[model samples]
Each structure stands twice: as structure tokens, then as C-alpha cells.
Target: MRFSATALLALPLLAAAAESPYEQYKAKFQSFLSNFGVAGPAADKASAPATPSISTGKAKKKVTEPKPIHTLTLDNWKDTLYAPVKAEATQPEEWLVLVSGRNKTCYSHCLRIEAAFNESATKFAAMPQSPSLGYVNCDDQPVLCNSWSAGTGNLWIFEMLPAPAPVDIHYKRLNLTTVTSQDIVDAYTGRPDIQWRKFEGYFHPIDGFFAKYGLSVPLGYFFWALGAIPSWAMMLVVSFMTRTMMNRRMGDANRQGNAGGGAAPRAAPPGDGRS
Candidate 1:
């Protein structure tokens, strides 16, 4: 009779446990806390599962930064910048590079941000995995700047890939306002919070007519210009050429008449009968 009564009483407790799983979890969590010297009931601690050592992540030892800052000019950009980064790697490597586009005429805009940009570059250069920092002055190296799609007062971030892989441009942001070092670091490590605007000619198709033929089709354009000339314009050219020829012939005749004195006797021949 005693055993039956005990079993009937325990049934309600088991039912409560099954009905509230969250309550059981809470007790287990409390017990886990108790393992860390947190006070809890002995029975609860005894029922808690053994805890295992967990590691969030390993910390990497930071090394000294390299000479990240460089000037990308027309003369050395191909050999210095492009060739080295594009070299094949035993294990694939990706390089993060940041480029600033500025002009001497951009004093009002670029000058203000220039100080902050330099400060950020100094900070970024100290990072263990520092990014390549470079700048292109449009006026100084217009061709190189154009190839990089760099416009004045703009910043570009690109991921340089190995050979055969095209460079990946991540963002192009106009630097109207100066930013802090933390802001720059966050932007370099991850993406910036603000919306990004594209560089000039973003909407232009790269493989356009002029881009395809370039200098090779220069004379070709002249031929096309000739074909496109209006009929009235062609008539004007022809009229001008004919008038020039007529003037030259008349001039030659005048000169010949003066030199030979043949024009003086023509009037006497005509008036011979009347005289």
C-alpha cells in the first residue's frame, strides 16, 4: 500500500517534467553555473551532465606590417603592381588593395579628406594583414588613372587575384567627408554601412565602339566621315575646286598677255573695217 502511494505521487512530478522541458533546461543551466562556483541545490548539480572545455577561437600572433603605401604611376604600374600580384602562387593568395584617385584641381574636396586618408593609411599599414595602399593623381598619370577607373576625390577597393583571374573591384566611394581611423578599419575589414556610388562612366558598356577599335580605327573614322558627308557639302567642295582651277587659268592668261603684249593688237584687228 505504501509503495503504491509513492508511485502515484511520483507520477505527477514526472508529468510536470514532461510538460515543462524549459524548466528542466533551466535547472541544468543552473547546475552548469554551479560548476563555475555558482550556488545551486546538490541534487540539481548531481543530475547535470559533465562539462567539456570549449574554445571560441585561436588568437593569431600579429607581426610587423610591410611597406603597404605605394604610388601607382603610369611608368611602373604594369611591372611593379600588376606583374607581382598576378604571379601564380603555390597556394592561391588574394590581396586587398585600396587606391585613391585625386587631381591637383581637386584641392577643395580631396585636400580635406587627404589628411584623414593618410592617417587611416598609417593605421592600416600597422595591421598584420595590412592592405596595399596606393594613390593615383589623375593629372599626373591620366592614362593610368583611366585604366584604374579612378576619378577625382574617389576611393576604390579591389581584390587582386592570381594570374588568369580578373581583378575584383569591391567598392568605389566618393570621399566628400573625412572619416575616422576606426571607420576606415571597419570598412577595410568588412563592408561599409553606407550605400556606395559607382565611379564615373559606370553605366557605360566597356566594349563600346570607340573602346573596341581605339587608335587602330582612327583612319577608319575619317573614311566613315567622308561617306557621311551631305550632298550639298560635296557640291560646295566641288564648286570651290572648280573656281580655284578657273582662277588659276585666268591668272595664267593675264600673265601671258602682259608678257607677250599680244592683247594690245586684238582691238585693232576687230576695228579694221570700221577704220
Candidate 2:
């Protein structure tokens, strides 16, 4: 009878544990997968069309594609910036500008702008900056910024300068600096030396974040967070100090003015009033 009672009491505790938050999360994730038409837990082990099965006479198993992952680096910096050139009378063409911080291991990939290209007499320009896309236009140039995800990476391509009235743009990559202005003119009938400029942008330092947790966060996140600190704090501090100094100076000036005998005594202001 004692054993039976203890067993019955333990059953309720086990049931409570089974209904924990972790189990709830598992249930919710399963439902999410179910909505996508997969057979919950057995989706990986089942012989379904989406899950490819391989058999070697002795055993059969389902195969799943590997998941893609982004690398977290402390020293790598892949940030980039772009600045486009404005048109001038002497230089009547636009140029694409690019500045990128290099990564120690990974090469910066798919670095390009997305803009319109056509035959025109005036210079047209489009630029892209890290965290934003910037552009400069001399004439009423048409430019587009399109970023499409191609598989695991992004695709960015655009035009810098429009071609002459007779010629049209055939390729998207504008390698004008490498080629002479006359070459560009010959390639597109009267277009001048419209080139793409590139430079280095701000890069996040590696191992900068580990200091936050006492475990030493990566430098990249640390520098990034430090850079994002509010500028208003510094401005407010400086303004406060300035105001304090100005007040002290004004107080000293007031003391000096009082000591300088600037105020005359009301001598006999009104002998006529009351002696």
C-alpha cells in the first residue's frame, strides 16, 4: 500500500515536468513544421518525397540537406561604403565609388550597386553606402537600387554613367578607370572617363565584445556597440561645462563692476524730500 501511494504521487510530478516550457516550445515548433506539410518528428526518418532515402540492401535512411550558417568572427571586417562623383562641365560623366574593409579570411563578395543604365548626353550617377545607399545626380538621371538574394548570398549590380544617345550599356560592371576615357568613349560613342572608385570603410575590431560579460565578448561587437554610443552625451557634457565657465566669468565681472565704483551713491537725491 505504501509503495502504491508513492508511485501514484510521483506520476503527477513526472506529468508536470513533461508539460514544461521546453516541451511547449518543442510542441510549437512541431506545429510550425506541420503547417509546412512535413510529418512532425518522423519527417527526417520517414520515406517521404521531400526526404530522399538511400538504401544499400542492408539498411535505408533519409538524407537532409545541410543548413547554411554565417561565421562569427572577432577580427574580420567586411563593411563597405560608396560615394558617387557629381558631374561637372569639364568632366561630364558620373563615377561609382566603393570603399570596403577587408576580412582576414573571407573575401568580400557580390559588391556592386544597382542602378539604371541607358544612352544619354548627360552624366548619371548612383552610389551605395554601408547601412544605406547614397547617390548624386547632375542631370535628371534615372537610377535604381535593387538587392536580390541569390541562393545564400546577395546580388548587387548597377550602372554608373549613361551612354551617348546612339550607344547603349551592354555590361553592368563599369571598369572605366582601368580603361581610358577614350576607350569608354569608343565603347559607348561619346561617354567620357566614367570610372568606379573604391576605398576602405570602417571595420569592426575582433574580440571587442568579450569584455562586457567578464568573459570577453568579441572585439567586433564591442567596437560596433561603442561606435553606437549616443553622441548627445558628449555634446551635453561640453555644453554644460561651457555654461558653467561662462557663469563663473559673469560672476567675476559683476564683482569687478561693483568694485569699480560704477554706481554713484544717491547723494542727497532729494534734499527737498525730507531732511
Candidate 3:
């Protein structure tokens, strides 16, 4: 009876000892603190404000603005300015040349002018045929400088007729003491003499064909296939005719040989009897 009572009492103690490690550790810590005369809030009763988890996601890309086109020199003049104009320039078309010096005052002023022109480049591109803008460095190109007579700190506007023979380039000095981007654009577009050439004749059969169908963007491969069909058909027809002719000739030769040749001779029997 005494052993049974002791076992029942030890059963509850063993069950308490089998509790979670966190609960047991907390209980022991609390007991240790109590033994040292230190008081703290109960583990279950105490509440703490949670610290938010910081999430590190992908970094965004940096956006940068486009750099403006600066002053044009003789080396880059043809590629940057003149070539584009030449490719598009029809008869009676012209280019607008902006001439300036490379000195401290003129260079800064020219850059300001160039920046203004660059901003309006999109607007110019929209036109059917717009005058190309170019900068002439007077110090570098003395011949062009003398030809245009581009004075230092002066901005001149010119109409260039890019003709094959006797290249005619005309200039009319602008009366602007203070130049702006809009001023250059206005002067070029507003000029009454700037003539836009019209498409005179059909350059190719395909061009005419597409035009007849009112198709702006032609399917080039479709046209190429269409063009190849006739040649391919001709080649096939020629090959078939040649093959038929050869087969007819072979048949005729066989028929002729059969008609002309006689049966096998009985000479072999006679020769064997003679031997």
C-alpha cells in the first residue's frame, strides 16, 4: 500500500518532466531567477513586438538620358550630315548648313545652336524631305570657310544644290544676333524655294505591280516565287520534250533494225557437216 502511493505520486512528476524542452527550460530559468531574488514576467504572459522580415528583391535598372549631338567637323561632316541628305536629296533639294568658329565664344554658342537643332531632329524627320543640318568648323576647312565666308561668332544659313556637275551652294546670312533652336528650324522649313522632287516614273515592274494592287509593303518572296514559276515551268517543259524526243528516236531505231535485219542463217548446220 505504501509503494502504490509513492508510484502514483511519481507518475505525475514523470509526466511533468516529459513536457516540451522550451517549457522545461523556461521553468528552470524562472526558478533560477527566483532563487537569486530576480523577478521577471512569466514566459507565457510576456509579449514582444515583432520585427518585420526585410525582403531583398531584384534591383531596378538605372535610366539615363540621351547625349546631344555636338559640333560637326570635316572628318565626320559627310557621314553625319551630307551623306544622309545626298541619299534622300532629289533634284532641286537643298541642305541647311550651320557655320560657326571653334573659338571660345563661338564654340559655346555653336554648341547651344547644335543642341537646339538636335532637339528638333525628330520633327525634321517627319517631313517628306527635310533639309539636313551641318556644322562647318571655319578653322579646319579654310576653303569652305572662304567659299561660305563664315565670319567668327556668326551663324549663316545656306541652300546647297548637291548636283553632279557645277555644284551650286548658295548662302544667305541670318540677321540673328542671338540664335535659338527654333530660329534655325523656322528658317529652314519656312523657306519658299525648297523644292521637293516627285517620283517621276515606275522604277521597277514590281513597283508598278504593287502600285496597281495598292499594296504599300509588297511581299518580296511572293513576287520572287511568282517570277521563278515561269522559268521553272519552261525548264521542266524543255526537259520533258528532250526526253520524249530521245525515247522516240530509240523506238524508231529499234523498229528500223527489226524491219531491215533477216532471221538467223542455217549456215552453222552446213559448216558442221563440211568439217
lDDT of 1 by residue, 1-275 (tens): 25787798899999887879987787889989988998665567678888988886987777644345567675675344455463565432333334443444354566655565667776776767766666666656555544444456655654555644544455555446755556656766765565554333332112224434453134334544564678899999999999999999999999987899754555544555665
Better of 1 and 3 by lDDT: 1
> Given candidate 3, what's the lDDT at residue 75?
42
Candidate with maximal TM-score: 1
Residue 31 deviation, candidate 2, in Å? 63
In candidate 2, position 189 carries an lDDT of 35
Worst 10 residues of 2 by lDDT: 141-150
lDDT of 3 by residue, 46-125 (tens): 46546798878867865433323335553454344335335445554455555665553254445665555566665566
**TM-score (all chains, Cα) for each model:** 0.43, 0.21, 0.35
Q: Sort by lDDT, best first: what order?
A: 1, 3, 2
Taken over the whole model, the C-alpha lDDT of each candidate is 0.58, 0.34, 0.53
> How many clashing residue pairs, candidate 3?
0
**For model 2, how does the per-residue alpha-carbon lDDT over 1-275 read when each residue is reduced to its tens digit?**
25787788899899888889778898899989899888676546466557567676775554433221112122221122112322322322222222121221113331221111121111221112111222222111111100010111111122332222111112224442243323323433323343322211221111122222433333333444444467898688789999999999999999998898877777665566665
Q: What's the C-alpha lDDT at position 45 in model 2?
A: 46
Off by over 4 Å in 3: 1-90, 104-111, 140-143, 152-163, 175-177, 192-275
